[model samples]
Target: MTKVAVLGAGSWGTALAAVLASNGHDCTLWSRRTEQAEEIAEKHTNEQYLPGAVLPDTLKADHNLARAVSGASIIVMAVPTKGIRKVCRDLNSVLEGPVLFAHVSKGIEPDTHKRISEVMEEELDREICQGIVVLSGPSHAEEVIRNQPTTVTVAAKNTEHARRVQDLFMNQSFRVYTNDDVVGVEIGGALKNIIALAAGVTDGLGYGDNAKAALITRGLAEITRLGVAMGANPLTFSGLSGLGDLIVTCTSVHSRNWRAGNMLGKGKSLDEVLDSMGMVVEGVRTTKAAHQLSKECGVPMPITEALYAVLFEGQKPIDRVELLMGRMKKNETEDLAGWS
Candidate 1:
């Protein structure tokens, strides 16, 4: 049994801590809210996020970062992408020993457009880090918490690290695949939220399957383009991290990004959506970042660009869809891989 510390106590974090503890690993879930931590420790439940699911009695919460990670061999980061840097900034100073880090959050940073792993690298630096791994795929925390069968990927620069993560989390109802495509995994995991929002917009606009399919297809195109330009294995885009993740995020009702986008498509303003959700809709922030990155890299991400306009520029969602539908046609695979 591995000793695992999950750094976030949100739905995903608690769900994964349950995964570890249920598998007989020593799991400590940490949360910023002391009362919430106390509640989880006492009740073995997180009513705020994972309702109707009883956490393993052994799964506990610790407010102390050092205590949370003391002898743990694996540290899972399930915090939102925006806070990853800060989490690492605090974590680097007091981490007792080197441990494998598996970041499960999705979303690129604004302005920098750095992936989660890259941000972790910047915070901890390579010399201080033991290993970096990413856990991602179509798996949703709601389903995973219910012990549903779900598939995910473990990605790292070293295949060994990937394998280690896979071994750590694999179980009867949960399947973990290992891959070395860190860039593709990170980028695919991050960018799909954007397309998921777009998919939601399609649904909200009352557009049918054809529109959603086209959005998914083109979104994958631009995502792969940026991933290839950034040194990811092109094939990984077709795997669990890329295509698999995109499909799940775009289609799942549990997806916050898609839901937020659907709200926007249904006539709510961005502020209204944010006020109502009160959670990190990673895709909205990520859409802005992707728009900036595509411009910097000269990658044509028309869908992302259009979404950005709607979110930030106050463009009408319907008009954006109209424009996307009227765009000029091109070959399915033409210059899409960034081979030039």
Candidate 2:
């Protein structure tokens, strides 16, 4: 069994640690809070994050970062995008040799506009890092904790690294697929949160299924357009990390981004919405990065533009929706052709 360290005690991180432990690996989950770590280690429950669920008996927890990763062969980075660099710096100070990293966070860094893997590679010392892998898809933490059947994709520049992650996480209830398109996988995983938030807004506005269907379809188009522009395989957007993640995050009540968007659609201030949702809404941050990317890449992301206005430009959500609906028409086929 592999010695695995999962950094982060959030719902996703805790649930993944349970999976690793259930697979008979020596998995240790690290939480910044000492009390939370003690409670999880002794009580076998992370009540705040994974309420009503009991973690695996073998799963351990640690408040100390260095102790958690000591002798670990694989490090599962489940922290939010914003904390990645700090965590990498900490790991660099303590780590002794090259270790494989599989980051589950999905977001594009604003200003720098780098993917999570890029940020990790930049922050982590070259000699101590073996490679970077991304594991992402439509699976939600709530469902995964219940052992509900879920499938996700792991992508990396090295096919061997991707396969290793696949083997580590794959099980009867949790299926893992391997992909080599790191750019497409990362882009799809990061951008779906943006679409999910928009979808939540539509739901809040009481827009019916037709509006949502159109938004999702067009959102996929925008994602595909931008992904292709960023040197990613367009076909990857159709796979689990792309269209699949978009559908689940946009439609599911379990999605934090959707919930935050729903609050915005119902007329809550962005500050208020963020305050209420204790978890990080990746979509909110990703929207800003995607908007910037659209400008830089010369890609027309009307939905992203509309959402950006609502999110940052002080425009009402409904007004932005109207603006989106009122935009001049374009040939759908012609738009798809532009992605090439």
Best by lDDT: 2
lDDT (Cα, tens digit) per residue for candidate 1, span 271-323: 99999986789898898999999999888898998999999999999999889
Residue pairs in steric clash, candidate 2?
A: none
Assess candidate 2 and give its TM-score to the true structure.
Answer: 0.99
**TM-scores, in order shown?**
0.96, 0.99
Q: Per-residue lDDT of 148-242 in model 2, one digit per residue for the tens?
A: 99999999999999998999999999999999999999999999999999999999999999999999999999999999999999889999999
Q: After superposition, how far is residue 113 of candidate 1 from its true place, in Å?
A: 2.2
Best by TM-score: 2
Against the reference, the lDDT scores of all candidates come to: 0.89, 0.94
